[model samples]
Target: MRVPANRRTPLHEIAHARAGDKGDTSTLSVFPYRDEHYPDLVRELTAGAVRRHLGDRVRGEVVRHELPNLCALLFVCRQSLDGGVTTSLALDAHGKGLSSILLSLEIEVGEIEVSPSSPPR
Candidate 1:
């Protein structure tokens, strides 16, 4: 997940992801490689950001739930399972690929100003 020399890098470099699904709802959990990055990661990985990243693949709403104690972000993407594994014709109806796709999102590297909501490192 290491990106070229630049001011930005893929989120995967700083975090890892896990995904789960039930019916047409999919949840993606983003855990930071270090808790120090948790706040910035949360600010960057909003519901809207995930929604935009997924584009038309997500027909319904995208919601993000924060878990500060765990230094993780949980994204709930609705209507994202291609109508659930049982109905979808696609082989990956479970939406496992969505987790990897989330990891592909870019985040600022080098130095980034911490937001007021961010916790101390």
Candidate 2:
């Protein structure tokens, strides 16, 4: 079904995410549920946009890598781990939960057909 024009929806509704971290950088990969949504993801999920959405959680730069063949976007976030897994005092020292936070970000889907088969978070 088509969602309203300019309507905001949490990214989880359209995509799924996976995240991993090494040292101070976190790598997040987001895949849209439908391949047709790739361009929309590319347009909306910019490096600056992710950095702004993450706020102080990401102290360094956010770089986005596009994988058009996979219909995915990979975000490399620097200085986000509070140091590293061993050094950070944060509860989620590995930054595993960052994907959840990333999914919570709202995007304007306009009139796209959101798949009802979107998996649960």
Candidate 3:
């Protein structure tokens, strides 16, 4: 486990994400700020872990697609928003904010990987 001895930070600090929905499924793309973090991202960001993290919001198994060439991960979240945005009555109809929500999940980072003085892209 890459647990932090100091303080933990969210994925947004080291990665960028985009989310979209089709019917009841939400697809998220997470791209690391640097290529060096791809392996670490792969080790830490598993489908089961994401499934557990999202809990009931995610009704089915999470699917993870590794893109080493791009240093990114694509996550397919099934039945995540009650239903499709068009059918769901939730305030966040498009599930647009889910990316930010995902980015909020904590992960450990070394000072070299994420410096306080540096800005996240």
Which prediction has the highest lDDT against the true structure?
2
Model 3 vs truth, CA RMSD: 3.7
lDDT of 3 at 26: 92
Between the candidate structures 2 and 3, which one is better when assessed by TM-score?
2
lDDT of 1 at 73: 93
Tens-digit per-residue lDDT, 7-64, candidate 1: 6678876789999999999999999866767877876888998999888878999989
Best model per TM-score: 2
- The TM-scores, one per candidate, come to 0.83, 0.89, 0.82
Determine which window of 10 residues in candidate 2 has minimal summed lDDT.
Answer: 112-121
RMSD of 1: 6.9
Each prediction's total of clashing residue pairs, residues at least 3 apart in sequence or on different chains, is 0, 0, 0
Candidate 1 positional error at 92, Å:
0.7
- Candidate 2 per-residue lDDT over residues 18-74, each given as its tens digit: 999999999999998878777779989999989999999999999999999899999
lDDT of 3 by residue, 9-62 (tens): 777767888998988899989898877666667877898877776777788779
Q: Model 2: runs farther than 4 Å from truth?
A: 114-121
Q: Supply candidate 2's per-residue lDDT for 66.
A: 97
lDDT of 2 at 55: 93
State which candidate, 1 or 3, has the greater lDDT: 1
